[model samples]
Target: MTQERISLFVDHIGPFDAQKIGVLRGKANSGLELLNGHNIEVVQGFACEFDRLERFGFSPGAKIGSDFGDLDMALVQITRSKVETKLLVAQAWDATRVGGRIVVDGQKTDGIESIYKALRKLGIEPDTLVKSHGRIFWFERDETRPFADWLEPKLKMPDGFATAPGVFSAEKLDKGSLALIAALPPLAGHGADIGAGWGFLSRAALGHEKVTKLDLIEAEIAALDAARVNIIDERANFEWADVTKTSGRFYDFIIANPPFHTERTANTDLGVAFLTTAARNLKPKGQFYCVANRHLPYEVVLNELFRNVAEIGGTSAFKVFQAAQPRRL
Candidate 1:
C-alpha cells in the first residue's frame, strides 16, 4: 500500500536546498523563525518593505529581487490579494528544482483554501494544515503543472504601456497621473520620476522638448523590467532603488506618484519620505511635482523641505502638489 504524504509541522519539511532556501515577499517571516541559522535567501520587490526588513535585522543569507531563480525549495507567505498570490505561486513553481517543494501559508481571509484548490487543478495535491486563523500547505515538484501561464508576461495596459501583475496601476494609466501630466509646467534638462511604475510618467516627462534626460526610479523589479521595454528612448534611465535612502544627487526636476500605503495600513510616512528624498535629490532651484490621495498629510513635509509649495491641480479624490527651491537643511 502507498503511504500518505502530508505533514502538519514545519519540521516535517523534506530535503531542500542545503545551500539556500528562498522566502518570497515575506513580510512577517512567520515560518522562517524555525529555519534560523540555516541559509535563507529572501526575495522581496517592494523597496519600503525591504527597508523595514533590513532595519529589523532579518539578516537573510542572501537577498534578491523579484526573480527567485532556481532553488531546492521555496516558502511563500501568501499575499493579501488573489492576483498577487497567484503571481508568487507561479514564481515559486518556476524557481524550484524538480523534486523540490513549495510551501505556502496564509490566513483564511487571504484565500489560502482557494489557492490550495487551484494547485490541485494543476495536477499537484498539497498537504495542508489549518491553524491560528490561517492555513499551511506544501506540495512536491511536479512536471505536469503548467505554471507559465500564471506569469502573465508583458501584459499591455490601457495606456499602451507594458506592465505586469503585482505592480502599481497595472491595469491602466493612473487618472491622477494623467491630470498631473497635464498640469506639469515646462521642465528642462535631466529629470527623474520617483516611484516610477512601468515608466508611464517618465515617458510623458520626455514630451517637454527641453527635458534632455529622464530617470525612472522604482523599487519593484517586475515594474522596472516592464519599464525597460516600454520606455525605449535613449534619454530614459532606469534604476531599482529605495527612494528614501537615495540622496546627494541633483536633478532639474522630479515627478512622483508616491505610494501611500504599505500592506493594508495607510502610511503617510511613505509619501513623506518620497517628498524628502525628492528635495534631497533635486538642485536648489529644481522643481518637484507629485500626486497623492487628497487626505494624505504630505504638505507639511513638502513645505518643510522646499522654499515654495503650491497646489497646482487635482481632482476631488487626488491632489497634485508642486514644490521648488529645495531648502538646504
Candidate 2:
C-alpha cells in the first residue's frame, strides 16, 4: 500500500529537473527511479531498508546531524509517529534551499490529514494530491521557515534511558523485555542482544558478573544511537544491522525481544526470522532467550530449531522462552 502511494506520488510529480534532491525517511521501493536522471541523496535509517536500497544500486546514507542542506528539492516520507512525521517534514524544509520545492507523502492512516491541516495552521497552503488512501503535498520553501522550530525538538527520556520518537517502547521500558530480563540466568562468555532497542535488555544482561562480552544488534539507527548513550561499557559492542539477513558472527548465547510489526500490521514472519537467525548464529551448545506476545506462534519455530525449549517466565500477556541445543543445519 505504501509502495503504491509512493509510486503514484512520484508519477504525478513527473521527472525531477533539480540539480540535487534530498529524500528523508524514504523506503527501498519509494519509486526513486522516477528521478533517476537527477543527483539524489537518500537518508534511510532502518538497516533492512538501507541495505535493500544499497543492493538496488542507490547510495543511501544515514541522516547525521543537520546534513544534506541546500538541496534543490526534498522529498519527505511520513512515518507512523506524528512527532517523527513532523520531524521529517522539518528536515525536508531544512535541507531544501529557499524557494526550492518540499514534497511530502503519507498514508491517511499515518496522520497525513492532520499534518496537512497543521501546515495550513502555519499559514502555508500546499499543493495537494489525494490518492490511494493517501496524500502527496508540495510547497516551496519560503524565507519565513515556519517549521524551523520542529527541526530539533527535544525528547524526554523515560527512566533516564535515552530514546527517540518512532522507536519501539520509546516512552517507557517494555514489559515483555523486563519479563525476559527477569527470566535470564547467570551469563558467561560472549552473547548478543538482537533487536536491542534502547539497550534495556543489554544493560540488564551486562549485570551478570560472568558475562565477558555482549553485542547489541539493532536495525534502526535512532534506536542504536540511544542504546549507545544508554550502555557505555567496554564489554558492549554495537552494530547497525538486520539480524535476519546478516549476522556474521556466532555467539555463546543470544537474547532477543524481536519485533513482530511492520508499520501498523502484525507480521509473525518477522519474529520467525529472528528465531531462525538466533538458531543459526548460536554456538553448538548455545542457549537462546526471547520474549514475545503470548499469542504469537513462535514455539513451532523454536521447537524446530532447538532440541530443548521451555517457557521460563512471563506475565499473562507475554511469554518468555528459553531454547538450548540448537540443531546444526
Candidate 3:
C-alpha cells in the first residue's frame, strides 16, 4: 500500500528536469526507480530501510544533515506521527533550493489531509493530486521560510532524555519496558538489550553492580541517537542494528522489549524474528529476559528455543519472561 501510494505520486509527477532530488523518510520499496535518471539522495533513519537502500545501490543517509541543503527537488514521505510528518516537510523545504519544488505524499490514514490543511493554514498553498487513497502535494520554495520554526521543536522528557518526534516511546518510558526493568534480575558480564529504545532498558540493566557491559542494540537511528545521549556511562555500548537479524557475538544475558508492529497492523512474525535472533545470539548457558503484551503468543516460541522458560513477573497488560539454556540449532 505504501509502495502503491509512492508509485502513484511519482507517476503523477514525472519526467522532472531537476538535477538533484531528495527523498525523506523513504522505505525499502518506495518505488525509487521512478526517478532513475536523477541524482537522488534518500534521508532514512530506520536501520532496516537504510540497509536495504544501501544494498540496492542507493547512497542513503540516516539524517537530513546540513550538507543536503541544495537539492533541486525534495520529497517528503509522511510517517504515522503527524508531528514527525510535519518535521519531514520542514526538512524537505529546508533541503530544496530557493524556487525548487517540494513534494509531500502520504496515505489518508497517515493524516495526509491534515498536513494539507496545515500547510494552507501556514499561508502556503500547494498544488495537490489525490489518488490511491492518498494525496501528493507540491509547492515551490520561496525566500520566506515559513516552516523554519517547525524544525525547532525538540521533545525533551521530564527525565531529561532527548527524544525525537517519531521514535518509539518518545514521550515517556514504555510500560512494557518498565515492567521488564522491574522484573530484571541482577545481570553480570557482557549482556545485550535488543531493540533497546532510548537506552531505558539498558540503563536499568546497568544499575546492577555486577553488570560489566551492556550493549544497547536499536534499529532506529533517531532512537539510537537518543540512547547515546541518555546513556553516558562507559559500560554502555551502543549499536545500530536490526534485532531480527543474527549477530556474531554471544552474550552472557540478553534483555528485550521486542517491537510487534512495523506498520499499522500488529505482526507477530516480527516478535518471533526477534526471539529467533535472541536464541541464535545467546550462549548455551545464557539467559534471556523479555517482556511483551500478555496476549502475544511468545511462549510457544520461547519454549521451542529455550530448554526452560517461565513467566517471571508482569501485570495484566504485560508479561515478563525468563528463558535459559538455548537449544542449539
Candidate 4:
C-alpha cells in the first residue's frame, strides 16, 4: 500500500511496539516498512516517552496531539488502569474510519482480557492472537458508539483549578506540596517548577514579588493545559516538556515534588532524575526546594547533586529539603 493510503497509531512507543505494529500491518498485507513514510501518529502524554519515540524516528505527525480523531487505523498499547484502558479503546474506536481496524495489545496481567470483554459490549468482536504473555486483538470499525462519557472530564481542583484523570493528584491538592510551600523562603529572579501539576506550586511561588518570572514545566499535556487556565500571570510560562531532557541554564531557583512511582511500582530513579535535572538547570549559587515522602531516600540524591542540602521543614508523612550551590558535574 502507498503511504497516502495508510495511517498508523502507536501509543507509548517502546522496544516491543515496532514488532506489534509490523504484525498488525502484515495481517492486512500492507507491505509497509517502519520508515515507509506512512502517516504514523504516536500519542503519548509523557515527555520522556515521547522523546523515546523520537529516537525511534516517530517524532509525532503534526505537533503533539492527544486526540486521535483523524486516523485510518490505530494500535493502542493498553495500560494497567481500567479507566485509562477504557478511554484508549474509546478514542481508538472513534478515530478509526469505517472499515479501518483498531488493534490493541497488552499483557494479561494488565487486564487485557477485561478490555476484550468491554470491546464485545461495543459490538466489536476482534480477531485475537495470543503470545508473549499477552494478547493482540483487532476489529474493523463499522458502527460507532457514543463514548463521550469515557473522555476525561475537567474536574475542579482546589482554588478553582482544573484537572483531569491520568494527571497526578487529580482529586485534590497534594499535602506534601502544601508543606513545601509553607516552608519555602522568598525566591528571586526567574524560576521553574519542574513537575508543576495544575500550577499549584507555581502559583504559590508568584505570591512573592521577588519572583520576577516562573515556568511551569510539566510532562502531561492535560495538566499543562489546565495550568494555563489556573496561572494567569504573564510571568508564568507553560512548557509541555520532560524535566530530565529539558535544557538551558535559565532559572535562578527550581522547585518540584517529583513523581516516584510508575504504575503501582516504586521507582526512586524517577525522582533522582528530577533532582539531577533541577541541579543542571539552575544557575551557580541558585537554590532548589522540593518535598518528598518521608520514607523516600532522596537525601542521598540531593547531596550528590548540590553543594549543601538541608531539611527545611517536615511533617510526619512529608519532608521538605532546601539545596543550595548546585555542584557542577
**Top TM-score prediction, candidate number:** 3
- Of the pair 1 and 3, which is ahead by TM-score? 3
Q: Highest lDDT among the candidates is held by which one?
A: 2
Candidate 2 per-residue lDDT, tens place, 1-329, comes to 55676577677777756998998887777677767788989989999899888988898887644668888999888889887889888878877899899988888998999999989999989988888888888999887778876777667677899998889998877899999998988988999999987899999999998889999999999999999999989999999988897555678999999999988899998999999999999988899999999999999999999999999999999999999998876
Reference-based TM-score of each model: 0.84, 0.95, 0.96, 0.81
State, as a TM-score between 0 and 1, how close model 1 is to the true structure.
0.84
- Per-residue alpha-carbon lDDT of candidate 4 for residues 21-51, written as tens digits (9 for 90 to 100): 2111121122133324445556666666666
Better of 1 and 2 by lDDT: 2
Model 3 TM-score, all chains together:
0.96
RMSD of each: 5.0, 1.8, 1.6, 6.6
Superposed by TM-score, candidate 2 places the C-alpha of residue 205 at a distance from the truth, in angstroms, of: 0.5
By TM-score, rank the candidates, best first.
3, 2, 1, 4
Predictions in order: lDDT: 0.78, 0.88, 0.87, 0.74
lDDT of 1 by residue, 16-131 (tens): 34555677876533545555565667767766567666765675322345555567778787776677788788888887888777878777776878888887887777887777
Lowest summed-lDDT stretch of 10 residues in model 2?
Answer: 1-10
Model 3, 133-195: lDDT tens digits are: 888889999888798878876665847777878888888778898898889888999999999
- In model 4, the runs with Cα more than 4 Å from the true position are 1-38, 61-70, 152-159
Question: What's the alpha carbon RMSD for model 1?
Answer: 5.0
The global Cα lDDT (0 to 1) of model 1 is 0.78
Model 3 misplaced stretches (Cα beyond 4 Å): 2-14, 154-158
